[model samples]
Target: MSSDEVTDVIDPRPARRLDVPFQGFVVDMVSDEVDLGEAGGIVRREYVDHPGAVVVVALNEDGDVLLLRQYRHPVGAFLWEAPAGLLDLDGEDPHVAAARELAEEADMNAASWDVLLDLLPTPGGSNEAVRVYLARDLTPVPDDERHTREAEEADMVVVPVPLEEAAALALAGRLHNAATIAGVLAAAIGRASAWETLRPVDSPWEYRKN
Candidate 1:
């Protein structure tokens, strides 16, 4: 089976990076020297720097999951994804960011939240990480409370699809986007097995803790 089983216990070590000149809500590039005691002492790597992110697996009362279809310029394809966003707000709590993304991207709100899964897209090269939240107890944003969309957030299609169908699309690689693929399948298997609730919303993530 192709899988990444967690086997290393990272020892706390100091890291250093030189800032690159790029202006954006999230870091685009980084120069890093990370200490991996088990693999090697201190190895240098340069890759994209992501502020981490959140994916909202919001389920409506009708048992449908919210999703968005957006045009990705890089991939040159319209990708289906869950409501997600970067941790751009300084000192902002991750759960709050997740809620904000759900409202901004889907024009909806969730009253209940659970830490469904954690994702590290490129642990070997990038420190990017994301938390998937299972959001239930749905509510809609007031007409006057909708967010003004821009850039990638603008002109996207939002729809609700049944959770099982969504999972099948993901497992078949039709979903494509890492966040959507992970979020859909995790939520599906998790719900079937009554998944363990381990990490809290405020759990400290080591990948982005630096």
Candidate 2:
């Protein structure tokens, strides 16, 4: 079979299940889950349905990446990340949401954008797909009068980090967000054509001088 036509042969089995609904989210409970009959059973199992989001790795003419440090209530701490947000409740385009989020969260706009990668934040539990985009030729947008409750609660600080330095910080575990790390790595490795290369790969996160 062609590579594209190749498929896995998964055995089927009976399993117990439960669904717990919430006001804004739902929990799926599964017991006596399917066993592939492997020695380790399954390295991962269970899938949670989630609304996907987009992350923009926007770079300016000066070669600085736009990053945000926002206060996360769940973590009860400030975390650095690229501008990102979930699709609209009515189901909006992921790219459109990325552009809108860049504008809404950063007060910035990009002249061009290209998708770098689509990744699952947590495949084992959540089906949250995060689409990372490389944005170049940025333009600043006028501050709008619109904002969301989440935005209002977020004390967002926009900082421009040199691409090289950003990668280094990520390797040092200073940049903890998975999507941001993936986006930066994608840009550094030249997978993202919209970003200019500033270094080479010495490690998964370390960039070498080019």
Candidate 3:
């Protein structure tokens, strides 16, 4: 099958957003006004329209997963998370973005990449979504090739946790980041399948343009 065809996804019909009134870095605020025809009532709901992103689950030979500790001003905490980045670059593949972030944040490279899971973390309030990639066969980039860190990332800490411990932290609620929690659990499931269950790194991203 082609990369654009996702056999696992069943979608005969889907809703498409028609109105976008605002856009910003934090979130693209939008208002959807609706009418209740029965009683002639009207309603408006405001929400965030995200550009989506990718998260990487980088694992080594011993099954240790690379994680990052970075301070987020909004949450007022230095949270532990898998390396991830926004899909801000036009025409960039999600898998490529994931690999770029893993290198930038962890100074490592992966020879194998697969889509572990796709999640809409907060569908009730936002169209923000994340695609988690499982990356293995790790290698470290040469020091000269590593990207320079800035801003919050300048103080970021890279830590590798055993797969079991990482899963525990995610399941027990210690891993507060949404992508990290989902990625760890998804990796656990992928391990059970001997990694055969994972989708191709370039699997169809039906929601990328939504």
Best by TM-score: 3
Residue 195 CA displacement from its true place in model 2, Å: 6.2
TM-score of 3: 0.85
lDDT tens digits, residue span 1-210, model 1: 345775556665777876554545566777767787876888877777777898999999987899999988988999989999888766778899999999999999998888888888888666788888988899999999999999987898999999999998887878899878888888888778776743567776665543
lDDT of 3 at 3: 78
Pairs with steric clashes in candidate 2: 200-208
How far out, in Å, is residue 130 in model 3? Answer: 0.9
Residue ranges of candidate 2 with Cα displaced over 4 Å: 1-17, 21-47, 144-154, 191-210
Please give, for residues 1-210, the per-residue lDDT of candidate 2 as tens digits: 689978434344444443333325433333335445655564334555556777999989998899998887777778889999876455465667888899888888888887766676775666466778888899888656445436633667889998888999999989989999989888877634544543311112111001
Residue pairs in steric clash, candidate 3? none
lDDT of each: 0.83, 0.71, 0.86
The reply for model 3, stretches above 4 Å from the true place, is 1-22, 34-42
- Span of 10 residues, lowest total lDDT, candidate 2: 201-210
For this target, which candidate reaches the highest lDDT against the unseen true structure? 3
Writing each residue's lDDT as its tens digit, candidate 3 over 1-99 gives 787885555342223345778877756888776564557566666788788899999999999999999999989999999999998877888888888
Every candidate's CA RMSD: 3.5, 8.5, 5.0
**TM-score per candidate:** 0.84, 0.72, 0.85
Please give the RMSD of candidate 3 to the true structure.
Answer: 5.0
Q: Which stretches of candidate 1 lie over 4 Å from their true place?
A: 1-8, 12-25, 33-43, 195-199
